[model samples]
Target: MFSATLRSRAASSASLQSRSLATAAAPSSSSSGEPLTHYRITLRRSAIALPMNIKGTLAALGIHRRLQTVFHRHTPDIAGKILTIKELVTVENVPESAVRTKWEQRQERKASRGYEVAGSKLGAEP
Candidate 1:
């Protein structure tokens, strides 16, 4: 019984991956000279209450929290994982230059202060 279930899940994931890749490849191939090399995947929905396999797939993609974003090179394996939990996440094709590290993502999320400091308080001769 367990083997049958696993086979069905694998089949579904494979089919979904093919369909998604076909659709995704169409526009990029015709639209630009530069190819998109990375996938910007964001966890839009929580995996809570979902099947353990679904949660595991998300973990495999390096997404542990809702709204978290991770970048991965465009590959068949990654595409399969994305398709498995397609409803729980959002995917975008990005150029290699757009890929950012975890620290870079955090830095981009931070807001800049409105004013710049002319001098530090410690610089004053009291």
Candidate 2:
């Protein structure tokens, strides 16, 4: 039973890695003629309310808030912090010039003239 469980866990881990690799390989566009490499540091999981010492460690590497900042390259110091918060983040690399997806940047426009957004689907037949 134990052996079967371990095998299943290993397979799950391998599948996750494969999916991550696919996301990392998504194409990105470049405008400038300069060569550059890009990386994406995604905060997969986080331990909220970090201890003071841990906060200092993260501050030392310029990361303060959770799920913030997309840096360019992988630095040793950053890698170390990542190790410290290994449970909190998942770092990946992507093209530097990659554009944000349209849906990601779409914000709900506020209603004008005192109109409020009802908590209902727009254009639903009532």
Question: Over the stretch 101-121, how does candidate 1's per-residue lDDT look in tens digits?
Answer: 999999998899888898788
Candidate 1 Cα errors over 4 Å, as ranges: 1-33, 114-126
Backbone Cα, N, C clashes tallied per candidate = 0, 1
CA-only RMSD, every prediction: 15.3, 11.9
Could you tell me every candidate's TM-score relative to the true structure?
0.66, 0.43
Q: Which regions of candidate 2 deviate over 4 angstroms?
A: 1-17, 20-36, 99-126
* Span of ten consecutive residues with least summed lDDT in model 2: 99-108
lDDT tens digits by residue: candidate 2, 27-74:
322235534454455555555677876767656645656665445365
Q: How accurate locally is residue 65 in candidate 1, as Cα lDDT from 0 to 100?
A: 95
Worst 10 residues of 1 by lDDT: 22-31
The alpha-carbon lDDT assigned to residue 61 of candidate 1 equals 92
What is candidate 2's CA lDDT for residue 58?
57
